[model samples]
Target: MAPSDPVVDPISSRLDYDVGELRRAELAADPVAQLRRWLDDAGRAEVPEPNAMAVATVDADGRPRVRNVLLRNLDEAGLVFYSNRLSAKGQAIDANPVASALFSWLGLQRQARVDADVEVIDGDLADTYWANRPQGSQIASAASPQGEVVADRAELEALVERYERDAEGLDIPRPEHWVGYRLVPHTFEFWQGRRARLHDRFRYRLTGGSWEIDRLAP
Candidate 1:
């Protein structure tokens, strides 16, 4: 095939982001509030999985890993997400509590980065969230040994079936391994894409019980 032939050529892919500008005057004084504003914008724009974020953690072996996690709760205290304690991310967070989470609202050409130290939420809170989850998800989270090697799909289906049978007519209590963590961010950076790759970035730093915003070079 000729190099110029479109059939054999590399698939087309590129983005010339030209989203709305992010200015200090338009931003909320608090980073959390600013995040909420962007979230609202993302929702209005019909961005898929607006609350999904890429959580990054480093294992004991010094390898970096990133996975998508849903944002369950957000407050001044921290950003909350849940995971099974036996999962790779859970183990990594336990080993090194410091982590980073990134929210890429590519539909709006915006992103948010958070660098934080994490702590497990109270048992009561975890219970509350677990109780609200669908029965199937609860059973799956409780039954499956996350991150563990299994024989096959059949093994998992069997485990789920067994758990469902055992949980019949009874409340499936939240497993100890199924817990929530709140990431208390010390730094947050917000980015808005622009034409010609001249983007806008603003970072908020927590200091002396207050937040200070600093504009960063694109």
Candidate 2:
């Protein structure tokens, strides 16, 4: 917004947690394997939405934006997340395919960040994921223009209802714009909280055909 824009109510927020120290020997040599271990820990600890992550991308004008997306797939290939290709984020990815993703598991006193070049996943993969989506979500995907603003809530609701009714006896096809992006990260950073201000951090960089791990000063 411009400097002349009106302001809303001012507010502040903060939180502190009692977290355990992270040891260098506790991490896996392979960053992807380490990430998987941490994710499993998040699930075992019952941390809400263990697969939710923040995806960061740049707009056409060079402004950066971030949004929370479910981590659909992960492997040596990269991290995958699905979205409407026509949405603001998808459009941004089209214009600028490089992106970053972050997973913050505070309950586990851990966080992971990946920075990489991004691109749409194969059509077969997107098709499989779309077919497995819940029916209600498929309807919403069909009805919603994603980033487009609507004049009224009723209009959107009615559109969804129409799509649902039309697909009563048929499968809800994925919108043409609905697809996935894979982040082929060259760098991965994992952080673990500790007592006092001394936290532990490690970075894994893709070098040659293997990974090079380095400890970061906390």
Candidate 3:
């Protein structure tokens, strides 16, 4: 017998939000600075997991996948996150070097979207970040076999216990399979929601190795 084909959903109703009130006047001169300001505001607003972002990547077949990952670092170079090289996300990134990330701060009614080209960071940078992590996190990294299927919770607990005992009072080394990745942004969009569904939207696109900011239709 053959397997059944998957069902597809039809087009849904259109819902429009006019983004007009969010003007360039509300943004910083520099997009990076604007992003930082939003991040700071999110932190002050007590948003849970302010540093967390939805990372999206495509597979070889062009199917997109997304998952929530902690934003470990961000700068002019772009956003950074760490993961196991052998994990599903790592494999997807290796196959397709392009990715996108989205940051949503519901409390502030703001969201930032980024589309970028990605590359794995150097070992030295990964090591420095690894060293700063709490001992428990380091131990957890060693114990968790990301993207692998385990028998049950007991198997994971056993591995955690073993690593905890083995790493007792010793310097936890960064695992060879774990590393950081940097996403170089080619385009970034900032969205701010306002009353009556009129919002602000500004986009920055890379042009001639420089950023060109423009007001996009809301």
lDDT of 1 by residue, 1-218 (tens): 65574654445655778868888898899999999888888889999999999999998888889999999999999999999988999889889987899999987899999999999999999999999999889999999998899999999999999999988999999999999999999999999998878899999999998999999999
Model with the higher lDDT, candidate 1 or 3: 1
**lDDT tens digits by residue: candidate 3, 12-63:** 5333544334667677766777888888878988999998899999987889
Q: Which should have the higher TM-score, number 1 or number 3? A: 1
Tell me how many residue pairs clash in candidate 1: 0
Provide the global lDDT of candidate 2 against the true structure: 0.88
The prediction achieving the highest lDDT against the true structure is 1
The candidate, 2 or 3, that scores higher on lDDT is: 2
Candidate order by decreasing lDDT: 1, 2, 3
Runs of candidate 3 with Cα error greater than 4 angstroms are 1-21
Q: What is the lDDT of residue 6 in candidate 2?
A: 38
- How well does candidate 3 score on lDDT at residue 200? 75
